[model samples]
Target: MRTVQYELMRPGELLAEKERFSVAYLPVGPLEWHGPHMPFGTDPLDAQAVARGVAQKIGGVVFPTLYCGTERARTPQELQCMGFEEEDLYVVGMDVPANPVKSCYFPEEAFGMILREYLLQIVEQGFRLVVIVNGHGASGQLATGERLAREFTHNTPATVLFTRAMQKLEEGDQRLGHANISETAMQMYISGDSVDLSQLPPREVPLKTCDWGIADALEFQGLGNAAHTVEQDPRDATAQLGRRYVENGVQRISDQVLAAYAELEPRQGTKA
Candidate 1:
């Protein structure tokens, strides 16, 4: 029951837990707009909570959540369709728009390189296993972690496990959303005061559809939307549902982490 957070632990505490420090959890997400009801830090916050739970159940330390991530691509045509001018879209980390908005973005290549360096450092720190848990569901961000895991395992002794929390759910049970029922519910459960149901818009906004590519296909099916960011209605969101999602997520991630750590037993012994 030692401190699960790496940044909060004292040097001696870390040493005391060194034997259990074979794994490190890195929760990565973006600081993007959720909605009026939810905070913009929802992604990283959820990621950190899930990571901490996994670390507590297994033996590991959860690093401080990484708030920078790849942004949703906003092509010129898409922007125009959304009725957003170029200037209307504020740069990452900028506090403009004065509304519910903010996205700390980095190019995919840069983000991938950053993750690679992070994994290298984690390996150097003597962790035989690392889990990169991304709360954001962007394809680019997910791919970045997967690519880094593959490349890092090939080049280093560390076994990197990468996944998006929402992706772990079964197809019919998946409740992925921006600030919708699932996300809002999870946030409400994790941080009770962070979400204000009363602040949700009075009515739902329609989302635009696209004609080309898989991204567009998903978008057309209400998977991706700009204005009505919520995938499902938030009216039914409750703290109870959120607890279910959080617990399910923690169980899924913990199982994966344990499986991956077991796979690294030989490598871990080699390092020892």
Candidate 2:
């Protein structure tokens, strides 16, 4: 059967599924550099790939990802390149362009407003459940996404699910951090054609010993550090490992969504 994708589904089919449970997925990623080997849009693309698989198993509509979020450029030159034409030099966070640092763009107030409107619009269109599936380094945004989800759910008759921390799956001794073996492997397994394994750089430092020096030393007065150049060597990454990560990620998210869906029922006044 053809899986439901908002971009590909016909209007009539979408209307037919109005009463049935539908999920709207939003994948958030930054425009900043990942590494020479991986495309700059790696986070968002990887996120969408995983999200599509998860949504397919859950049987819901997968919406296009929202590429803008909290991001920072790795260097002043990069930031200049990204924010070059923009009028506001200190636009902040993901809005600042090629995010060089782990800084989050979109302030709390702005995020709340934007998310609230998005959820309300989805609910108005009859999708009761919404999930913001993000694959970024910053976990704080998950809290923001969850808060918006909870607020939307409480204020309206809709149900929202945010896949925050991966639970129920063992760590499996795989590197789970940014642009590490796991993510690179998943990209190779999922988006192999788009992924240029030769571009991936060799990991100079061990994961356990690496520090958040760049983010800490930013000091709000000087240029931030560029850590995007670092990545797990693709030589050590395998398609098999990528497949395992994708499978585990999909299973974990599906389990959570199914559990959440069972507990949810639309508000009495609103239609499900």
Per-residue lDDT tens digits for candidate 1, residues 187-256, read 8899989888776445554322121011222332434566423345665689998887877888998888
- Model 2 per-residue lDDT at 78: 40
Off by over 4 Å in 2: 71-112, 164-169, 172-174, 200-234, 266-272
* lDDT per residue as tens, model 2, 40-70: 5666776687688887787677777766555
Best TM-score among the predictions, by candidate number: 1
Question: Candidate 2, which ten residues in sequence have the lowest lDDT sum?
Answer: 208-217
Local distance difference test values of all predictions, in order: 0.69, 0.58
**Residue 65 error for model 2, in Å?**
1.0
Angstrom error of the Cα, residue 89, model 1: value is 11
